[model samples]
Target: MDTQNSAGTLYIVATPVGNLEDITFRAVKVLKQVDLIAAEDTRHSKKLLSHYDIKTKLVSCHEHNEANKTHQIIAHLKNGLDIALISDAGTPSISDPGYKLVTAVAREMLSIIPIPGCSAAIAGLSVSGLPTDSFLFLGFLPKKQQKQKQALEAITNQSATLIFYESPRRIKALIDNMRTILGDRKACLAREITKLHEEYIRGNLSDILKALEEKEVIKGECSLFVQGQLEQKTIDEEQLEKIIISRLATTELGTSDLARQISKEFKVSKKQVYDTILKSNQIDS
Candidate 1:
């Protein structure tokens, strides 16, 4: 393909997340026909290439060297050499390497195409039995316990289903954090997806935690789909009024502070609560 007059195309291909047969035919074709293949791990990708008889040259493009390789990849694309970008598993750049290279290619106005296929996040969500209408994909959380809890707290009010990827070692901790910060909502832990020993544990967060405790050792990578925060039932005006009065008499919380606390707890407007508090004349406006 002599596109010397014009820059070569950059193909973002998707590979199997687990099962070798999960890749799309288009992905295989692109991999074979491309002038070069930029892989997250050359050794890891070699096995997949060998399986399909693809002899295209491979270059290492992982997190450590992705920034440095981005320039070289762009140069190749400019010199009329079509290239394909793929990760060890699933599509590149989705919580994986290749984001930098893809962005560089796009900035250069080169033709960029996607030969999409398997994705673990989507696969796990499909079988999670949670609401599919809306979802938020959080690939992984911070390793520190405090940071992880803070991250979960930020999403405690989200109504969309939450999808997270975790390793077997930390799956237990991640589940516990979710339960503590997000409440014991329903969840599904999809492990070893699309593989021989694939398993899906479905139930409340507490149930999943109990099951994991019983296991001798948790194996394989895991994708957890957790139910989002549910809508809080509105508190009756009379009940709300009484609570406001009781707080005013019992606590030192001022009108503004008390209104904020009550509003958050009951999912009502802060102004509404504040007005009710003012009506009681128990706290100064």
Candidate 2:
């Protein structure tokens, strides 16, 4: 390979999430032909490689090592050796480390190709039986319960279906936050997708949580899809203003809680309701 290898390309390949044979033929061909494969976990990837009889060399490119490995991988591509970036499962950059490397490579004016195949997010949405025209893919929420609730609250009023990825260990906790903050909106949980014991449980968030708790143990990553907020109806400004004034006079709810309660009653966003409440308070003062 020429040191000035200007024609080098970076292939973003997609591996299977659970089933080995789910990989695309083009992906397999690219992996075998690339000069090198930068995998999230080379050890974990070896099983797939061995199953497919791929002889290409693989190097570690996970979250811990990606920052250091980026330069080396870029150097090889610059030296005219084409390379492929793959994750332990699914596409390279979806909630993975391929973003940094891909961004760096794009800056250098090298070609980057995508060999798309399977993605757990898309797989879950396809069969979720929810509206899919518009969606928000939240890879994972924060670990803290408060932070997770705040995150959900921020997007509670969006009319787009919400999708999330979770591990078996924290799936219950995540559902708890969703139910608390987003209410028991219709949802579906797809577990162990594409595997032998794969299952999809459909219901409101609370029902799904209750069912999962009954199982002695759970495993595999979970894909969750929630129906979007109800369509906004025609709101009456004067009517809302009167309700706010009456509620303040008649009830002892704090401003934030009042906003939450009123927002639900009127099918408006919490932020909008809160902002109006602030303005009302300022005007009274």
Candidate 3:
């Protein structure tokens, strides 16, 4: 309903993740009405558009070319040509391309609309059976082994449910890493969601790893929903101080970073950790 004066609106459309019928009626109408559709993959999106008989012109706007395409998209918007942005599946900019274009459009004081429909993360979370009252949607983890561990260690004490997206090829490796870092926590692995072979493996991280090992080859993208730290043990001040001092001696992490990591790991106040760190620094000085 809200439209830019004379400029065209940039609609962030959400397409089906797998099953075509999963799309909403509103999304279909917008795709049909838009002057042009900017897709992450034109060839891949053509199948969906063809299924619904949407004949709107398609253009490439994927990660590789998104930078060059952003300026072009803005020029079209300035010329009053409404555009719809979509990805190969699910919503654009959700671990997909479109963030840069959206940001550029907003800065130009142009109208940016959202034609919300299906999101893989939300779809996976809805049926994950994990506590959804509070959640942390970490779209994907770092690829490097050490960086991956660092990322996992940073959130080791998060209380909210954790949601992550991973490729089928790397799903098993990710689970192995998680098991090593987060313990054998309860989890749900949603694979090939909304498709014929859609499967949900519910159990501990170890169970999921075993399941992956049994399979000949994993297929499709995967969403891993893991339970957060459900218990926090009290840390004695003296013991915590010694632990912090030892960590400082071994790691190059600064005061703030060390305090955060220690507080999360120990379930203590960051201020407490900071005070201990400061006192230790004074003593060493």
Give all candidates' CA lDDT scores.
0.87, 0.87, 0.90
lDDT string for model 3 (1-285, tens) is: 434688899999999999999999999999999999999999999999999999999999999999999999999998999999999999999899999999888988899989888898899999999999999999989999899989998889898999999999999989987765675689999999999999999999888999999999899999999999987867799899889889779755678777866776677888999999999999999
Question: TM-scores of the models, in the given order?
Answer: 0.82, 0.83, 0.82
Off by over 4 Å in 2: 1-5, 233-262, 268-285
Model 2 over residues 148-231: C-alpha lDDT tens digits?
878888897888999999889999989876665665689999999999999999998878999999999998899999998876
Candidate 3, position 17, lDDT:
95
The prediction achieving the highest TM-score against the true structure is 2
What TM-score does candidate 2 get on C-alpha atoms? 0.83
Off by over 4 Å in 3: 1-4, 234-285
RMSD in Å for all candidates: 6.8, 6.2, 7.6
Name the lDDT of candidate 3.
Answer: 0.90
Consecutive 10-residue window with the lowest summed lDDT within model 3: 251-260
